[model samples]
Target: MISVKNISKTFKLYQSPSDRLKEIILHRSYHRVFQALNNVSFEVKQGETLGIIGENGAGKSTILKILTGILMPDRGSVNIDGKITGLLELGTGFNAEFSGLDNIFHNATYLGLSRNDIEKKLDEIIEFTELHEFINEPIKTYSSGMVMRLAFSVAIHADPNAFVVDEALSVGDAYFQQKCMQKIKAFKNNGGSIIFVSHDSNAVKILCDEAILLEGGNVVQQADPETIINTYNFLIAKRSKGEDIRYQGDDTSSGYGNYMVRIDDVSLQDENNNPSEILISGRPAKIVIRLAGEETIDDLTVGIGIRDKFGQDIYGTNSFHLKKKICIKKGQILLIEYYFKEFNVGPGKYTVSVALHTGDTHVNECFHWLDKSVAFEVVAGGDDIFIGFVRLKPDFHIKSETGNKDD
Candidate 1:
């Protein structure tokens, strides 16, 4: 078990040269401070995988550093009940001049293993890393990913009581990534607590049971994986649209309220303004949602989910923040519109459904299933010229250093 209480971190960064010299020579501080974590607190039980997610500067890495004892927190305390082994940075504990064999032993010792203890697991670590040929080479010659693989191999081979992993695991190739997942799974099954940090939503869903969302140096929401990811996606959409947003789930202790809002109709149209189920791949497509608002609907948010034929949600969007509330009088019809940048969805029979939820609480209420909404066929053109999702207009130019002979 781990308990974090009012943990905060701030760094004083010098902007001006005079300030830096004054702080060094006269012991006078003249630097602006940046706050990374502000009164952030959370707990993780034994054998539980807790995920930390947020935007680029949301203090995710700062919290991990504090937890691992790599950086001391400016305020608050982290009460860890067990020994922690962190995989924060690639080659963080490695000496570039040392051979892989020597580096592994050194790093393992730093992780609290003695020489004799690490020698027993040396063969296993080399095998796990699959670096048989390069095991004796100097770490300075190794690629970034190779160093990561070897470092990870040594860290997990010792089997600490707790593991803290950042987004560094993606450094390895797909095959080695799968191996890392298996090792983490084994660690969890053996009652080890884990704190995983990643920006990949699918990774969070696959790995964590509970998660915490942080934004602007504040703990926004902490809940189940599904709920956390839903809130995260909504935040991403809101931020992309240049809006200030805050969303919280309904208080569970207040009991059940069955105020439902369901999607009544979904239709697709092309540029010609004709009803068409089949949409072209490299064109424009529009999704229209017709909903009958039940009860007094205040600030109703609508989301359109576009999935592949196999039911994996590729991308989605919604009116996460409009600055103005979409209050629907009881029994009033509401039309919600979602326009795609371009119809870049590959040729396939895709299904479209709408979700109506409260703006404050990103909780889904009514379920609308349009099994076979539209069948779209992409008319292909250009040989491998356009790639993935939307296609952008590009300009190519050629400049001549020498003018024409006549000139």
Candidate 2:
């Protein structure tokens, strides 16, 4: 369990690196103070999980550091009951010169483990990391991912009563990440508390019982995981309008969002799950859209369209037309995938258009619209090809002129 009351953190910023030394030597003011947090308060109870969602520079990391005592807050009080283990950074307290095995023991010791206690957990840690023979190698020689493995394994095995897990789960492969999530769930099920901080709203929803939203170094809101996540998403989208100005379109594309929601990213994948901007004719194709909204959306309609180079619309459909209602909360990334059994396209260039809107037949309800969002070439294969926009796999009957037709 953890509790913070009226906590604040401020850092003095100097104009230059040398100014810091000058100020220290002169004992005068040579810097301006920047507030990293203000009146922040939250609690994580036993057997419960608390998720923190915020943008970069929103003081999410700053508060986590304060909780772990990696940094001291300039104001307010923090009271924590039980040992706190943080997965804030991978290999954070590791010594590069030490071997993986040695670093494990060192970290375990720091986590309040005795030599005998570490020895008891040693084999399990090594086995979980799958470092194998490399466990004896110097940590400096290991890849970033390998170091992460060793660090994560040791931290999780330390068995602290409360976990301060940041976004460190982004490391390693998908399978390994899933394994770590499983362990986190298992830990919480066994009466452990977690302060889970991440930008992933869905993960927060799935793993946490409560959530907090941070913005401009302030506690914006703390409430049900879904509500907080939705508010956070809306704030993020609103923020992006001013800070994110990169082109979301190309020569054959155009895009615009209504600030209600935005398509963050899009991808084309094959049946094997390999991504590409091109598709092979008659092969399975997938369109994956990464979507986020400003607030809770209950009647969202997601649509996708395919068109030829000449702007001929080949196909288009929306969730509403199919009688499927899509509901999502803010900050939650809706990774919607549309799977097509076959491209059925002829060799040529085509563009994919996608949109998110409300009110089935109302253009005014368009929250976001993208045209030619992703352009791809459908490469024709096989000698039995015809000239058209698509392949129908036609069935035909032919009779020779000199021969009589037979029924």
Candidate 3:
């Protein structure tokens, strides 16, 4: 288990080497102070994975460094119940002149393993990396993905009670990355604690029990993975405007925009044109949206997003993508309906999110954006029984041929 409390860090930026010398001799400050972290705190318990997400310069690296002992905090404290290992920046703690095989022993020793222990685990670690043929090559000759394989292999095999993973995994190929994810899941199942930092929301939703969002050296929000990811996306949309962004909605539903166009009502309709919370798979359906215009907008776009119960985005589209243009005038009410010839989604619970904005995306001019505005379930109705999230309507055929054995 790992615990952190109100930790902060600051760095002094100097203009030049002369400024540092002058400050020491004249007893005057000549550098600007940048606060990278401000009273940030969180905890990871055994068998739990906590995800840390934020934009660049949000103090993510600073906190990770402090936790791993690479940097000391200016205030607050950190406590760890057992040994912790970290996979930080790419190629960190490695010798460019050393062969990959040599670096294994080098890193294992630094992790406090005895020489005998390293020898015992060496074969297993090498096999996990799948780099048996290239293990003798110098580190400088290895690709980024190869270096990640070696580093991750060594870090996991160290057998620490907790692991701190940074974005180094992003450099690995898809196959190796999936292999690492499986190993991390196994570690979590065995009661190991983890602090996972990544910008990939899908991975966080799949692997994390909870998540935290950081902004400008502060902890903005901490909650379930779904909520945190939604909040993160909202912040990203507003980041360009340099506004003081904050979550403005509740746990069940969230929304943000300028209120030029408002979603007055949203509903799902079955083939019979009746309001419904349940829909049949492979049947006709439609989504009805009522909009009120508070200000005249020459260009407007309507978007819809469908998400599974786990908060994974299944499908999304917008009027802009469909090549449809809209214009609303003040005090005008418009009713919009999107008809589906056949809703091909699999049987599952899903939520519908709606958005009104200018252009194709909401980032430029978001008039309004609502998350989980309506919830519905799809039930199996056709003759086919399928598994997973979508129905692809597969067509299959088979033929038998007669031929000589040596044909």
lDDT of each model, Cα atoms only?
A: 0.74, 0.81, 0.90
Q: What is the RMSD, in Å, between candidate 2 and the native fold over all Cα?
A: 15.2
For model 2, the stretches where C-alpha displacement exceeds 4 angstroms are 242-407
- How far out, in Å, is residue 145 in model 1? 1.6
> Which pairs in model 3 have colliding backbones?
none
Compare candidates 1 and 2 on lDDT and give the better one.
Answer: 2
lDDT per residue as tens, model 1, 230-283: 667666645543332333334321111133455566788875657777676656
For residues 331-355, what per-residue lDDT tens digits would candidate 3 score against the true structure? 9999888899888889999999998
Worst 10 residues of 2 by lDDT: 243-252
**lDDT score, candidate 3, position 123:** 98
Q: Which lDDT value does model 2 have at 4?
A: 91
Give the clashing pairs for model 2.
Answer: 230-330, 233-331, 234-294
Question: 105, model 1: CA deviation in Å?
Answer: 0.8
- Write model 2 residue lDDT over 1-407, tens digit each, in one string: 78899999999988899999998899999999889999999888899999898888899889989988899988899888878887887778899999999999898998899999999999999999999999988999998888878888888899788888887767778888788899999999999989998876667878889888998899898887755754554454445455332224345455655647778777899758899877888888899998987878888988888877655567888888988889889887788888889878788887788878786642536567676678888887664576787788865666678675543
The TM-scores, one per candidate, come to 0.66, 0.63, 0.93
Rank ordering of all candidates by lDDT, starting from the highest? 3, 2, 1
lDDT of 2: 0.81
lDDT of 1 at 347: 53
Best model per TM-score: 3
272 Cα displacement, candidate 1 (Å): 27
